[model samples]
Target chain A: EADIYQTPRYLVIGTGKKITLECSQTMGHDKMYWYQQDPGMELHLIHYSYGVNSTEKGDLSSESTVSRIRTEHFPLTLESARPSHTSQYLCASSLGRAETQYFGPGTRLLVL
Target chain B: QKEVEQDPGPLSVPEGAIVSLNCTYSNSAFQYFMWYRQYSRKGPELLMYTYSSGNKEDGRFTAQVDKSSKYISLFIRDSQPSDSATYLCAMSGQREAGKSTFGDGTTLTVKP
Candidate 1:
């Protein structure tokens, strides 16, 4: 089974508040990713990292930023949350480019 | 056009019924194909993975990939009510840490 985990499975916060979503994996995967998904919509990739200290923006434009200081942890931070930022955030990891990705339980954020 | 396309279906089926889900892609370079199942408010879990063409089966689930047509399918036989979830199709190309492109997902409900 995948050992990936996400913190604060559900969150409710006021607008303009700063929030951080934590993701960690015990599988020792080298690559990690963060995606934003709305109900009934496709998952849009926002950020991804290749091992430590390597981060890149994904296909979608996102206000949140991610850091990969350690191989197991990838955290996403939104400086100022908004109503539009209310959506499910998923974290995933893979051994390499062509490998299957394993995902965390996900975090549902509500920016009221 | 989107790289990958899938029907956004809230399809309801009785238990033990056969479930067929499909996805089409425009990117011929995509070498890896995958199916993921996500429950309500949860992140996706990798259900199946296929490389290039042909079929792969795991228990009640069968994944078929037609690289020539850029079409892929997942068939679930004797599906149980526990199988109810959103099924997403994802694909990636040859690059290391290649970002995956995802479909909108098809929601399946197997009612007992």
Candidate 2:
């Protein structure tokens, strides 16, 4: 089993508020990714990290920012929340590019 | 057209019925195919992963891949209520294995 965790299982906040979604894995993985998913929709990659100090933007464009200061911690930050940002954020980690990605429980955000 | 296509089926079936989920891709470069299951308010869990082609069976789940047809299938036998969830199909190539293309998930309901 993958030991990945996300904090704030559910979050509801007003527009213009800042929020941070936390993701951490104990698997000592080198490749971590962040995906945005709407209900029943395909997952869209937002950001990804190769390792510590190596972060890259994903296929989808997003206003959120991500950081990779530690190998195990990968956090996503939204400077100002909007209704459009209301969706589910999923975090996954894998040992390498060809490895299976294990996901967290996900963090649901509602920007009202 | 999208690279991966999956029928966003809200398929419902009774317990003990056989469930088949399928996905077709336009990209032949994709060598890796995967199936994931996501519960309500939770992240996706990788249920099966296949490299190349052929059929792989695990317990009550069976995964089949036909690279020539650019098609993949997932079958669940003796489906139970706990098997109800959104199923997602993802694929990637050897060049960029972690940058997978995903299909819109299919929602399934298994009634007991």
Candidate 3:
């Protein structure tokens, strides 16, 4: 099993609340990604990082931000959570850009 | 059109039966194809990966890629209830930090 982990496997919050989803890995990978998925839907990449201090937005426009302050840590922050932000957030890490990625257990958020 | 397309199947199969899942892509530039399995609220886990075209088999799972037709397939033999999960197909081109495009997952339920 992969060593990647996401904290607070499930979260329920109200609108306008600030929330941060934590993702960490012990694989020493340089490429990390964050994707949002609805129930039985396609995954939409929201943010990704090549390495520490390198972050980029993905194809899907999102209201979240991420920071890669450590190679093993990538955390996403939503300044103001809304009902539309309710979805499962997945974190993944790969040895390289095109390599197979290992995913965390995911955090399911329910914003009311 | 979406880069990758897959039927969102809530497919039900009996135990010990063979299950087939498929995905189609519109991007010819994609050089890597992968299959991921996600259980319940967990993040997706890589099940199989293929480069270019042809077939690759691992244990009870077989992955096939056909670049000419822009189609990919995954077959699971003797599938069990434990194999019940959502299957996602992903692909990406050769680029540094290339983001992968994913198809809407197919949910499989292997009944006992």
> Best DockQ goes to which candidate?
2
Candidate 1 lDDT, A1-112, residue by residue in tens: 7999999899999999999999999998999999999987789989999889999999899999999999999999999999999999999998865568888988999999
lDDT of each structure? Answer: 0.92, 0.92, 0.92
Clashing pairs in 3: none
RMSD of 3: 1.3
**Deviation from native of the Cα of residue A5 in model 2, angstroms:** 0.8
True contacts kept of 2: 0.70
Deviation in angstroms for A75 in model 3? 0.8
Residue pairs with backbone atoms closer than 3 Å in model 1 (clashes): none
| Candidate 2 chain A: worst-modelled 10 consecutive residues by lDDT | A93-102
Question: Candidate 3's C-alpha lDDT?
Answer: 0.92
- Sort the predicted structures by DockQ, highest score first: 2, 1, 3
DockQ of each: 0.69, 0.71, 0.69
lDDT of each residue in B1-112, candidate 1, tens digit only = 8989997688999999999999999988888899999998788888999889999999999999999999999999999999999999999888744468899999999999
lDDT of 3 by residue, B6-94 (tens): 97788999999999999999988899999999998788999998989999999999999999999999999999999999999999888
Pairs in steric clash, model 2: none
Over 4 Å off, model 1:
B96-98
Q: Candidate 3: interface RMSD in Å?
A: 1.7
Clashes of 1: 0
Listed in order, each prediction's TM-score against the native is 0.96, 0.96, 0.96
